[model samples]
Target: MDVQIVHEIFFMASLIFFGGMVGGAIAQKFELPDVVLYLLVGILLGPYGMNVLNVANGSLTVKLILTVGTSFILYLGGREVKIRVIKRVWVTIFLLSTIGVLISTFIVGYTSHLLLGIPFSIALLLGAIISPTDPATLVPIFKQYKIKKKVAQTVSSESAFNDAVGSVLFFTFLNVITSGHLSLEHSFVLFLKDTSFGIGIGLLIGIFGTVLISQSDYGFLKNFSPIMSIFVAITSYLVAESLGGSGFMASFVSGMVCGNKVYIGMKCNLENRKVQETVNETTGLILRMMIFIVLGTMIDFNIIFNHFWINLFIIFIFMFVARPLTIFTSTLPDGRADWHWNEMLFMCWVRETGVMPAALTGMLMGMNIPYLSHIVGIAFMTIIITLLVQATTTNIVADKLGLIDK
Candidate 1:
């Protein structure tokens, strides 16, 4: 609220703005993911390097900004999913989001416990927190590679839906670990309550928001549709959480409904028109630019070195083993046998993580939880490697495998 703080925020905003533009160009030239560039810029200008932005200690302003940005990013992620893909792959998505995620959590946790000497409970928490892939990176990479729709849908849908499941898993374990009395029965019941209620509320909000946009008489409202989506995402998340539901899930599902219903389907009469697609593409470009730039600026290099070898091992194994195993086994039964070996390999390594896991790490740390730093370290490292390495090379791999769309 201070004038000095306002000035600083503006200055940082401008810095991020320009930095994003330059980073984007660099990303395009180097065939890197724009998000990596954003994070790089953040690291350079943020307190970690040049000290141009002081969001290090977590100021209220910084938290608020990040929360808003993340909600919008998640909402936009939901907006990309269409109902058609949902119908065709609902079973796969459900299995992957719930059962697949649970399996990954257990595997990663047990592996960590054995290797890192952490308590079983804390290891499980770390596994749960890091299980779900971030859609921000997944979505872009899938689009870039021009993979088959079903394969893309599988990865994208899993990432979007599993975030909620992963979050629930994290909180469920946290409650059991922190609170005095939590039985498995209680945890199961809570999971049902949170998942169902979040979906219900998200559906209601999405329906209303879509209706409002569909029937609005004002011209200005159409121009500001992106802004309206921000509000819808926040309201859905908060309302779902207040009612003992998963805010993350609700926001995701609700945004999916709104996007497919209002933006991609019947309400979007102009969707097939060039202008509409252009606007949508522009919005995506600008958002991706800003998100990556800010992400880059938020990196703490100190965390990276502190957990270097251990974190690298986790990222490597997950990309090489954990994710591919999950996808290959889960998708095999669904008739994906025609996919080439290289195509299958490319599909295996599409993992990503972002703001949510990073923030959860800090929250756990504040609660005096052990292994919080390690989880955060892993989260940052995974994002860097996944987005920069996986995202950038996905297309090349796909091309080599002849999986690129003709």
Candidate 2:
């Protein structure tokens, strides 16, 4: 709004963007995950260090940048979800996204209370916020690690869908903690409503988007294809939000259907690696970089340090227990009974949670919701650690465990 803030926003955005490019290039050169370097850039500019870049209120500039960036990233993440692959591993995906999240939330929540002396409600909120892996930060390594098809599908499916599940649970729990009137009956009713409505909204959008593309002439639509998809994604999110459904799920489903839907006489033209699909992948790439950079600059390390141990414990559980249990259980149906322990281990620690939940947590905190800051701060810390630790060593771990092909 102010002239000074505008100048500051440009300056900060440029710095982060340039930093991300350098970090990304180096990470790729070294074969380390780029996400780790993005986060390292975040740490350098966050409150713990120079504090040159910060996420604050009263700025539409940052919000606009992040909103578009996040939407495009979510859509790209959604595009990665292949329905046919998921169908084979649907059982595993469902269990991990729903039950796995439930288990991790309770584990982290109860453990936080025991370990951090926090109230039960605060601990539970933290559990819900950081329960699911974020796909934006996972897909890069999914390609690098060359994990089995089933394992990769399961991880992507769960990551794509679990955000909606975790979000519903987070808000439901928040209602209970804030209002103190969340009965079992009320909770079940809310859960059913959220899940049903969210899925319905997403399905409807997916079907609509698919039909739109199918009926159009690709010959005439090439230039407009990207814009059309963006339109569909944004409208789906807004519609779902208006109806109190999960907009995140809606955007994802729309992209999923768009990615997999067959159009009459459409052909794959890989002449340009960036524009191979029916949708424009270049826009997706731009959005991904923008979102992660903006998100990186948003990290408030001071707040994280205030509650470092609590964050670490949550991260530990996710890395060592919840994710592994979900991946291993998901792989069971593939009939790969003789699992490579190292491959499984690499898959377990492959991905980390990221910007969406952090953004939601920040929103909740701004609303004066109790314990919101603690939950958000903890989630950010866990994301940073997960990206830095897991991304840096996933390849080494895979090789040491003899999972990599010679």
Question: Which candidate has the highest lDDT of all?
Answer: 1
- Residue-wise lDDT of candidate 1 within 1-406, one digit each (tens)? 6898789878877887798889878977886777777778877877767877655435555455555555655676777777676676676677778878887888778877877787887788888877887777777767765777866776787787788788778878887778745577987887788889988998998877766555445332454455557678899988988988888778888778867874454354353223434554565566555555555656667877885887788767766777877776666666523545665576676666665565455445436677666766776787777767777777777777776788
Regions of model 2 farther than 4 Å from truth: 1-5, 57-67, 215-223, 263-280, 328-343, 401-406
Model 1 TM = 0.87
lDDT of 2 by residue, 76-113 (tens): 67778887667666776777778788878888888878
How many Å off is the CA of 4 in candidate 1?
1.1
Residue clash pairs of candidate 2: none
C-alpha lDDT score of every prediction, in listed order = 0.71, 0.68
Worst ten in a row by lDDT for model 2: 264-273
- Residue 372's lDDT within candidate 1 is 62
The list of candidate 1 runs beyond 4 A from truth reads 180-182, 215-224, 262-266, 269-298, 336-342, 362-365
C-alpha TM-score for every candidate: 0.87, 0.85
Candidate 1: count the clashes.
10
Which residue pairs in candidate 1 have backbone atoms (N, alpha carbon, C) closer than 3 angstroms, thus clashing? 38-292, 38-293, 38-296, 39-295, 39-296, 40-296, 42-296, 42-297, 43-296, 43-297
Model 2 quality (TM-score): 0.85
**Residue 284 lDDT, candidate 1, scale 0-100:** 54
Error of 2 at 227 (Å): 1.3
After TM-score superposition, what is the CA distance of residue 236 in candidate 1 from its true location, in Å? 0.7
